[model samples]
Target: MAEILNLVGSKIRDYRKAKGLSQDQLAELCGFHFSYIGGVERGERNISLENLAKIAETLKVEPKVFFDFNHSFVQPPSDKKEAALQEVLTLLQAKELRHIQMTKKLLMEIFKTFPRQ
Candidate 1:
């Protein structure tokens, strides 16, 4: 139970950072106090489902995403190509949805124009 809380807290922190939002900013958006946000992130609070939903909505992610611990352990890239892919993923991780969609479209067009052998 404590471990689950910690995991959820860590996931929330990761998403919050990825979205480039500070604790205060996220708290403001979710109508929570900054201290509450900090507590949640630190696993010091047993967050309620209602509060969790609010945070999830504010973060623009589904609440279930926070519980997806199975894929949380990312292996380090083993090769140059994999490293490059990881770099690209990291770059896109912080982008807005529309920006990511635009990037995907651009990449698709470029690929169509230059087919791989």
Candidate 2:
């Protein structure tokens, strides 16, 4: 599906950026054109398995890594603020899950002090 392709492309872009490789550089490493790499990163190309394998090998990651989509990353925000909020929520979910219930209770009590909208 297009959505999965987009997700995979986005992850590839993220990893590529994190590894400090330019599209042209990645393309050279994978024996492809810079334009092709660009298209892949932008989700415009439905990458073939052979090419994907080459890319994975060039990137020093497993082929399966490209398809390892996490539920939290299923969708991305178009807005910067929403993206930041999502990242904060992800961190909180990972680090403060047990404290969430207490936080929710405190928020509910605080809300009671305010007039209904």
Candidate 3:
């Protein structure tokens, strides 16, 4: 349905921003025109299978990632360092973030106290 496509569009735009990719960059990687990316993002155009494949490959995710429009953050597996880092980062308020910075500095200083032993 058109509404579904718009939801997909917004999700794609969110992922695109999170990945720090511009529409032009994504379009180039997918071998499409910049307008095509814009149209897709605007939900004014439906993408073809080939475009979907190219986009999936360039985005480093499966084609179905485009359709999995969950707004909830998908935590990485327990084995992934990034998930742990994300957890740590999310614990911070602005003041807490400042404390985190100072904690990191203290840890760095503590580590520097030891020589190779």
Candidate 4:
């Protein structure tokens, strides 16, 4: 049960960050206190399903997305580049289609600015 709480909390944190929202901002949108948001993200609170649904609605994600923990079992990255890539992929998870497309375009533009090796 604790593991499930932690997994759900971690997923909520990931989705929250992906939406470019601060804890204060998300809490405000969900009509919750910032400390409550922190507690939820830290797995210190066992969130109610109704509250969880409110959070999901605020984050523009489906509630079930938080429980899709299969990807959380990934092995540690072997190098810095791999670690960074993994972080990027994690941030991309559960993001809206338009936002993902915007991110891809931004990445492409940023990469073009890099000098040839």
Q: How many backbone clashes does candidate 2 have?
A: 0
lDDT (Cα, tens digit) per residue for candidate 3, span 1-117: 787767667766766776679999998888888888888878888877788777778877677767865434353334668777766655543346679889789979999989968
Candidate 1 structure quality by residue, lDDT tens digits, 76-112:
4568999899889878877999999999999999999
Clashing pairs in 4: none
lDDT of 2 at 1: 82
Model 3 lDDT on a 0 to 1 scale = 0.73
Model 1 lDDT on a 0 to 1 scale: 0.88
TM-score head-to-head 1 vs 2, winner: 1
Local distance difference test, each candidate: 0.88, 0.80, 0.73, 0.88
How does residue 74 of candidate 3 score in lDDT?
A: 51
Candidates 1 and 4 compared: the better one by TM-score is 1
Which sequence of candidate numbers ranks them by lDDT, best first?
A: 1, 4, 2, 3
lDDT measured at residue 20 in model 3 versus the true structure, 0 to 100: 78
Q: Residue by residue across 52-76, what tens digits does model 2's lDDT show?
A: 9898888777778688775333244
Stretches of model 1 off by over 4 angstroms after superposition: 73-117
Per-residue alpha-carbon lDDT of candidate 4 for residues 7-57, written as tens digits (9 for 90 to 100): 899999988887788999999999998789999988899999999999999
